[model samples]
Target: MKQVVENIESKPSTPILGHVSPSDVECMEEIAGENWNEDCAVYAFHSESLFIIPKQRNIKLSLATLKSEIYTISPIRVFDQNIRFAPLGLLRWSSRSRGLHHGTHRMHNKNQRKRLWPIWVLLEH
Candidate 1:
């Protein structure tokens, strides 16, 4: 996980509207111990202006992909300011099908909700 994080951080940032391959998603999923369907291509957005929300507070990193549908991979915690090492929390958004699905573990408590509110805010924005 550390190696993956280091690799991502060391590589040059992709353009704002660049592409992310299925292999990249697969690699991330493997590192994060999550299962992400890599059947379709993924797009990458390198937003220099967008930081984690909940200003001045600790927030997790999130990656949004819109290949087959809109889904987000948000970490439970920030891993040394790099997202690659953070444990994953999957959020699936499907309008035509079922609505939002929050599949995060241990997020049913008030304290967990408080910590995750910033991620929701950032996703909405």
Candidate 2:
């Protein structure tokens, strides 16, 4: 896959959505690789971690081709600042551990509310 990286300095403050930086955008782009796009909105934290919500969750603004196979919409954690898909397919969980290239793992089936589950937040959510 191919990704497009933009060199925007400041983070974008999307009023209703909150603040997201160029570095965050760059990180998501890198992960989705050929699948990334500008419209993609990401949830990033101070720990330099991120969560992905799609380009436009509601409609026409919807992507022509739904790329990710996993139905849940949890964001992958990309730490090394590198992008790579996990080997195992965690339908609803994030990677078991942190860092890049370390693929997703099986999800804990305690409850089924979160479409996508982040490994760390599994206990709380």
Candidate 3:
């Protein structure tokens, strides 16, 4: 089912949503075929695409394809999860394959009860 919103309703201009809502899907379709802008960027966390909605029907975008770039944690590419400042460094993460904070979110003391000491050292130190 396709629902269209002729005029956007009240919502966060920049919502750090966990998923791409149904409206976002419709918006994506519209942007894809009808009125996509380049300067306006869409943060589709659910769909895992960073849309660059500029001012036309065809905007720059990053949709999940087989060849989509995968940002990963390697010994060289990203900082180690055990580094001294790893906790402070985890302010915001951007990825295409996973939703925001899918894997690296902060846990509560209950969850932390099961972790090893070194892991806590990284998070608390």
List pairs with backbone clashes in candidate 1.
none
Off by over 4 Å in 3: 1-38, 56-90, 93-125
Model 3: per-residue lDDT, tens digit, 13-58?
A: 4422232222333343443333222233344344454443323334
Best by lDDT: 2
lDDT of 1 by residue, 1-125 (tens): 35443434444443334332333344544443443222221212233122222212332234344323232333233323333222222343221112222323333565545333211212211
1 or 2, which is superior by lDDT? 2
lDDT of each: 0.30, 0.35, 0.31
lDDT of 3 at 50: 41
**Per-model TM against the reference:** 0.20, 0.19, 0.18
When summed lDDT is taken over every stretch of 10 residues in candidate 2, the lowest stretch is: 59-68
Any idea how many clashes model 3 has?
A: 11
Cα RMSD for candidate 1? 18.2
Q: Candidate 1: lDDT of 17?
A: 42
Q: Which tens-of-lDDT digit does each residue in 1-125 have in candidate 2?
A: 99999998975443332333334333545555453343332322223343444443421112223222112223333433354232322334443324322223454466764353423322111
Task: List ranges where model 2 is wrong by over 4 Å.
Answer: 1-45, 57-97, 102-125
Q: Is candidate 1 or candidate 3 better by lDDT?
A: 3
Worst lDDT 10-window in candidate 1: 116-125
